[model samples]
Target: MKIAFYGSSLLSSYWNGAATYYRGILKQLAARGHEICFYEPDAFDRQQHRDIDPPDWARVVVYDATPEALTKVMDEAADADVVVKASGVGVFDAELLDGVMRRAAPHALRIFWDVDAAATLDEMRADPDHPVRAALPGLDMVLTYGGGDPVVDAYCGMGARRCIPVYNALDPDSHLPVAPDPRFACDLAFLGNRLPDREARVEEYFLKAAALLPDRSFLIGGNGWESKAMPANVRHRGHVYTAEHNAFNCTPLAVLNVARDSMAQIGFSPATRVFEAAGAAACLITDAWEGIEMFLTPDKEVLVARDGQDVADHLSTLTADRARTIGEAARARVLREHSYALRGAQVDAILRDAAAARAADLPEMERA
Candidate 1:
């Protein structure tokens, strides 16, 4: 099958959390003999700070965010077997959704893959006239990064024909345990772009934890956090590159997963960092969220924290051997069940099922 995907930058992880997920899934899909083409807008300064070049497996087409450029992208996608317009494209998202829904060939299966399903659904439910909500009935399928059952049920209730969760997974080949570097070594570490939606949780879970454990070292990574005044024990490394993730994860005694507000409310939605940290054999500590057990068992495969005090308690008492045990268990679980290969296979099955269902509908509709 020929697939055309439109989303945020695939070459840059610079403030783009979906970059790793996209690269992993698409690479596996291409390896399975599906032709893949990615369309990304040249905004977001992603082009300027690219972490990787276009992969040999797929063509990455960069275009402007102007109307003409969007029309051209839609035209390019018209002939594909499956055309995907991912959520959080960060460039005229509503317009792109509308254009793809209107312009893709009827035979082409159109998908609205929500990388941030919780936030997208929240907006759609709050506003009756949202473009994505309006386009729900026309979409062939809806895929999400998180928000398990609640998201699927909500989209289906809102007139979507089909909705599926494509939760984030680990790419073991790229995110496995590495030699810990002293530069990144810390008692606790949290790596994420400082976004408005997630800043509060970062403060509560990461910064506050640091403050409480002033005796222990903490590392903060990613962009937009250079100016934030954190605890004396917390060292900020603004914009850690994608190349250094494995080392960073391995170096930390325990890495923290801070759920963004919407994701926390929706539950079951683990961010990309969760898998990455686990894959690198980093003991994981996370804020309380619903359905976390679906991914990792609390206090066994991972640790749960309700507040800074919980984090401080965990860090203060967890022995290095115990931390290593938890990290190893988490890594085993991810390698067994959450690899990109599993997700690629799921994508293949979902597309085939959708196409088959659509074909089955044609005969019945013709008779009617």
Candidate 2:
């Protein structure tokens, strides 16, 4: 099958958080013998800070962030077997959604793959005039990065024909254990760009934890956080690229996962970093969110924290051997049940079934 995916940057993880999810899923789809053409905009200096070159698995089209370029790409993608318009393209998102649905072939499966379903749903709910809300009924399926049952229910309630949660998973090859690097060694580390929705939680969960343990080292990575005030113990390494993720995960005694406000409140939406850190066998400390148990066994495979105090307590008492034990256990669990190969197969089956159903619904003469 030829899948044309219009999403955030696939060649860069600069300011784009969805890059990992796109690469993991689309690369796996390509590995399953599907042709994938990823369309991403040249915006936010992502092109200038690319972490990867054009990959062999998928064809990447880096188009300009202009109406003309968008129209051209839309026309170019009309022949794909499946058309996907993902959330948070950072450029022409609504137009891309409208264009995909408008340009897709009658039999092609049109998917609105929401990388940030919780936030997107919040937008739609708050603004009835949101473009995605208007496009819901036309989409063949709504796929999410996470947000389990709640996302599915919300999308269906909002008039989606079908909604599925294609949660994040491990790409073992892309993110596996690596030798610890001194540059990333710390008591606890976090790597996420600063954003309005997530900044407060980062403060509450990460910065406050650093403050609580004054003598411990805490590493902060990702862009747009240089100017943000932080505890004296926190070290800001702006925008660690994907290639260094393994070291970033492996070297830390425990890596913290703090979901944005919406995701924390909505629950069940795990960030892509969760799987990456776990895949690299990092001890993960995630903010308390519902449905985490569905992914990782809390207290054994992961450490769940309700506030800064819990994080501080976990780190204060954590032994090197204990952290290693938890990390290894987490890796073993994800390796057993959450690899991208498994996720890709799941996605392939879903797309194929949807395609088959579409064919079955056609008229006898049209089927030919």
Per-model TM values vs. the true structure:
0.96, 0.98
Steric overlap count per candidate: 1, 0
Predicted structure with the largest TM-score when compared to the true one: 2
Best by lDDT: 2
Instruction: Please write out the lDDT profile of model 1 over residues 16-106, one tens digit for every residue.
Output: 9999999889988898888999999998788988989888999999999898998898788776878899988988898888887677766
lDDT of each prediction vs. the true structure? 0.89, 0.92
lDDT of 2 by residue, 8-115 (tens): 899999989888888888889998899999999999999999999999999999999999999999997678889999999988888899987899877788899998
Q: What's model 2's TM-score?
A: 0.98
